[model samples]
Target: MTTALIADDEAHLAQYLKQQLAACWPELEIVSVARNGIEAAEQISAWQPELAFLDIQMPGLNGLEVAQGIEGATRVVFVTAYDDYAVEAFDAAALDYLLKPLKTERLLACVARLKAALGRPPAVDESRLAETLQRLLAPPVQGLARLRFIRAASGDMTHQVAVDEVLFFHADDKYTVVRTAQGEHLIRTTITDLAAQLDPEQFWQVHRSTLINLAHLVGTRRDEMSRLFVRIKGHAQELPVSRAYVHLFKAM
Candidate 1:
């Protein structure tokens, strides 16, 4: 039996897709269902399913990023809400792209293609997909492109924190902490992943595990051990600055 993975941030959508797949292709077995791109990547790495149905937009990491990280013969079908332009791009590149509000006919066609590709050597050019993802993620010149809000989880509750209110971000073990004037919230995204999505002029990485908002920066001080620390405008705690990033405050 061919195993598959369904990855989408929406739980309902993932279930709907699974039902549709089961109805159309009884031979296909869904090995896993992921709620976010991070979990999806982990499942893909662990199971290495024969096929992956990845939603384009997801928390922690987008579908493109997850797909790029995948190796070997796992065939990918990107599920997107993007317009015809993006669909055309994928079609022109010979990569499968499924539009949102999935139709049964469309999914049936995709399943047929997957069945044919099963046992065959991977024909998809991942390099081309990487280039396409880069183009899609690039911001326009008219304005700065950055996340306006972050969805953070705290135990059983989820909070939507505005980006401007964030004081700093620190990596804590497996999760990254999003600190704001109110308090700190946990996010599944890694520090490295958050760095790429934030505006460089506003958020600066002072250490390997710490990123601070320049608006909240008050000043910098050196300790007795010659260690550099950054002070926040209204916050009491001082964040350490690594030697690699100390050059950022040399002029100050």
Candidate 2:
């Protein structure tokens, strides 16, 4: 019943890994497959799959960066064509590393280790893994503090919106819209930049251009096609939830 995810830019390799995994560990359930690191990260955050097989080099973000940002219990396994990253993969606290043109024997051994690890109680939570991996892989940067307030502008006035009071942040054309219970204001910051300053648990990236405050999330809706959408407090319109983030609401 162990859920897993496979991430690789090479479609053929990803399929090959899936085939090998079926033979090596038939009991393992693959919850999703991602073609890029960004999709991998979003899926991991949403599904919290127990195991993630990741290729180091991918668009949007690298495998190391994706692994460093997961806020869940999912463990990572590096699958790349290069052996040079073996040392750094270990430094990133990857459960195991698999080289390209994967060998049956090696994969079986990895399966054995994964089974052992899963049989035992987790020694560390997902947050610790992320922090450790980030320390090892990411460069030090300033402005690490979370935002407390945002300057939202309207025509001639700039309103200071408390971070907690905001409902959601939406990117519209060139500006990002800041919504609150009272009204909406404009800000020029991108969703990526705003997300970095906000706590991941409080705000969620529901769409590529939208970061919504979980505190204001009232409900979710599904249409005839089973497509999902979210309803926020005081907002009449239901915001669409991208497929990458749909797993986050699985329990809801």
Give the residue spans of candidate 1 off by over 4 A: 85-89, 92-95, 139-252
lDDT by candidate, in order shown:
0.77, 0.81
For candidate 2, the 10 contiguous residues with the lowest summed lDDT are 124-133
Return the clash pairs for model 2, or none: none
Model 2 lDDT at residue 107: 96
lDDT (C-alpha) at residue 71 in model 1: 40
lDDT of 2 by residue, 1-252 (tens): 999999999999999999999998999999999999889988987787999999888987778767655545578898877787665665546788899889999999999999999887655433344444544454444677999999976778888999999999997768899999898888899776887789989998776568899999999988765667899999989887754356678877
Residue 187 CA displacement from its true place in model 1, Å: 17
Tens digit of lDDT per residue, candidate 1, span 68-183?
A: 55543466788888866448446423247677899989988888887887867755544455445445654333443678899987678889999899999998768898888878
Candidate 2, residue 152: Cα displacement in angstroms equals: 9.7
